[model samples]
Target: MPAHDPQATPADELSQARRLLNRVFGYDDFRHHQGEIISTLLAGGDALVLMPTGGGKSLCYQLPALLREGVGVVVSPLIALMQDQVDALRQLGLRAAFLNSTLDAETVHATEQALLRGELDLLYVAPERLLGERMLSLLERARIALFAIDEAHCVSQWGHDFRREYQQLSVLHQRFPAVPRIALTATADQRTRQEIIDQLQLQEAAVFVNSFDRPNIRYTISDAPNPRERLWRFLEQEHPRDAGIVYCLSRKKVESVAEWLTARGREALPYHAGLSDGLRRHHQQRFLREEGLIVVATIAFGMGIDKPDVRFVAHLNLPKSLEAYYQETGRAGRDGLPADAWLAYGLQDVITLRQMTQDTDATEDFKRSAHQKLEAMLGLCELTSCRRQALLAYFGETLEAPCGNCDNCLQPPQTWDATEAARKALSCVYRSGQRFGVNYVIELLTGKDDERIRRNGHHRLSTFGIGRELNAVEWRVLFRQLLAQGYLDTDLEGHGTLRLTARARLLLRGEIELHLRRLRRPERGARERRGRTVLALGEAEQALFEALRSRRRALAEAQGVPPYIIFHDSTLAEMAQRRPTSLGEMAGIPGIGETKLNRFGKAFIEVIREHPG
Candidate 1:
């Protein structure tokens, strides 16, 4: 650990931070608000940081802990990820250890003794264990530097990933009044942000709210009827042989998708709460240590995962809220590379989610909040305007113009006036008793004179054949839009029966206009487009990049750590392009810190030298 000077000026502290930043983390300068956040902690002040996932939130506390007097204690919610966190820090040559259930009694004792003797620079602890009496007493006896509360939004009851243990974290403030506390999270709306501040008792902390927009992620929402096929097309086109996550709404769907993808020749795994702990841990370890593997999971996975090179995140069903969506999608592109956030949803998703929300045994207010969040997510999917703009605005941020990277911006959708169509659809739902699901409703509208339709109703009804101007697919799209726009609602206890909301009266009376996005089939050759290139490497550089990656994989396997912990893909790309010949030149690269330059620099340099460029 670097020694801190008590008499150092603020500028001097900052300069030392910058030097350590290069020597330890291998970055040239501080990104966005990192320097200010670090300076606050160095001056013994509390902080509340809300930055995006890849926005370097860990550095804000980790760097300060290295420069401070004693060990920095990090309170994390995910116990499974603590080992990786400690391993990454240790790879940087920092004295870091974690105390969790995975550690045996002897290991725990050694780690605790290390803290007491002031021999550790940083220590990671789960919130549940940190709040225990033994750990609290142990901390009181040690010289503590600061406390970092990660995934701080979990403290909010209204947040998407709320953990009951987080609310108890306020004890940190009461116990260690002088130790500067920093609470950090990747996703937090205005409501969640306030709750975190309130629950964690960080009212006097310096709040640093960075922009919530992840511009590198291209958002795409498809309502195509064949979602599985669409997902395959997406994978085949954009992320072939890339590591990603596929989110489903149920454990059954998670397992099926994993099996289906595996049959289709992709290495996919299933992860959910239903699975045993040992199985979950095995899948997670394989995902971290291997390459191009996909994990099909529910919301149970991916809270504090530090894998940096995930290429995409796909959702087969609608998430409960935009907060959940943002957090899940932010998992991609953690290395500042281009990634995709894809969704394939339909009216069924809306119905299933609404029913799930209503079926929950929570208070009415909670149910209403969940419904509003679901509505917002639906609006995003049915939106004909810029998706990024509306998504940002939901989180209280504004994008001045359309982000050209999103589906809507790239290929603008055409809208048609569906006023009369909506009126006819609603009338069919009413005239047919409103006791049927979407398929039944659509069948009646498209003039399907099947036995069920004939037995239930007469073919002589006015709405029976009135919607012939639109095909079955078009009618499905219109019905989905109607439900999403609140002109129609589904029965809570029924089998997805359609019901008219009070807002539908005006449309029925022709008092207002209704315009909806025109449904169009995806282009046949769309999959031919190349995926986003992380670096503009020439042919020779590309070959050299592969060689460096092979070397990284070998080293990572030998040391039993993830390859990115050794050096991220971006770093290898830089090394391939620069072709550094000596230690000094290697140190000049972006991700080559002093520790790494001395540790693996020679091996990589030899690879660069021996490559046939």
Candidate 2:
């Protein structure tokens, strides 16, 4: 086994890639743009891949690695991720092993020995360990196939998860210039993708950009009187007794929400960086293994989980970027099941996310990047168009129309001309020495001359009583929209005092137009429980599902593992969707077992022809 050897001919490599694709991954087809990436890698070229989260990225590298007749050294970022991927690959009868800090020295030595003996198909290593001199030497001694960087966005300084260790991965190209390299990321905007190419020195690398759209997850945003009550209502209505994640912006909030869900008799757990390592691992493991469990956490969870049945993703606060939101929500519906992406947001979420970014010690360029992303997220939150369209547009993609599944597309929001409202608000900020907070300015404009208002002499201003037409809540909403639209700025040092930006000045002088979306109450009709549609199944799958259902009913009659345990309605529906043409495909369905398949697979296939599509 050596690092450098004569490369295979292009025709041979292409035939090898195609053969491995059908033999290993069990796919008779290649997704859009997959063949081009495969050809680039097989031709001994580097590539940067920007695909959506569930866009089958693993196969792009897995096929190339398996075809090259040597070990593929994959640089993974997390121990848990490496372990999970290795376990799945081994289950598929491919030889895969991982070396990380979690293993003892003896295990590490044994794994290195296996690599040198050319006994493994793919080996996962963390960037921290892979960049070491000893590790490089060991790799040099082995038959190197291809070097793959998973989650390559971490190398970019502008990405959410910037790791200093990832910067060291550039040495791979310098050390093995002949070996093909592929950097794959699920979530990277234009800037981050460019940074990855520049930082990884993939100057000659080909780039593949896929469409950033997930049409299955329905997006919904709500303004609640009390967010907890709304969250409970949402959980009860849409995703009861199903696995989901609730994301908050703080650890305390995570704990509080988890406890609150528990008090409400939900099987909920909390995870955060503040928790002990043992407890975090325990909770995470349980959440993965069990059903009907909810894990409330900050953004510290759901990186490399491959669970196929997550039903929903709820956000108690706004995420900082559309990319972050897209990646987080993608955790749901990985199995292509219909799921919900719900959010309960207010002005405070925007303020908190912005303050967090502003206080970080990153460079000014990083800060500006963060701000632009935040603004994009805010735009998504407040947009009057289809939420799905707005989200896809941010990623330089387009949609035909409103998805008709989101809150906005279901119930059109009302809009009001706020030109006069904006003028009054901006005039009040200017008259109050640009130092008063929104609350005080609203009070003065609505003609409440309280002690502070009189002390500040805001009552004497001409704009003081001009805004009496709007109520307190309406006024607050106006200012929130103003803040989000960049017409106003909050002085961070003075308790977020309202100050006018250039946009506000333009509005004050009637040089700019202003329109605001009035928050619409969730329609009572929208709350109705829509019945789930079972897929159109062929004769065999339908019979199989019915037989499985009959067995499930019998089991529920006996020891009682619930009909869902035998097979969820979703699993039955998917049995109809895929029409599993073979026994292996049947096993790939979520809850089907060999016993079940052996007993009922033929019957299901027979009934599949009669099943509705």
Worst 10-residue lDDT window, candidate 1: 526-535
- The Cα local distance difference test for each model comes to 0.91, 0.78
Flag clash pairs in model 1.
Answer: none
Cα-based TM-score, every candidate? 0.98, 0.87
**Highest TM-score model number:** 1
lDDT of predicted model 1: 0.91
Candidate 2 residue 338 C-alpha distance from true site, Å: 1.9
Q: After TM-score superposition, what is the CA distance of residue 467 in candidate 2 from its true location, in Å?
A: 3.1
Model 2: per-residue Cα lDDT at residue 561? 28
RMSD (Cα, Å) of model 2 = 5.1
What candidate 1 gets wrong by more than 4 Å, as runs, is 526-532
Model 2 C-alpha lDDT per residue in residues 1-613, reported as the tens digit of each score? 1222246666666666665565555445578688788878766789999887667788788877876657888998867657657765654457899998889999999999999999998999999999889999999999888999998988977777788888888899899989999998878888888888888899899999998777778898886457888888888777766788999989999999999999999989999999998788788767765666899988888875666567888999888888889888888876666778898888667667767778877888888989999899888888888999988888778898778988889878889999998888888888788887777888888898598777766678898889989998888778878888999877756377778887777777778798889966644533543212223455565666565556545643463223343445566677766777667777676545444556555655555645544
* Highest-scoring model, lDDT: 1
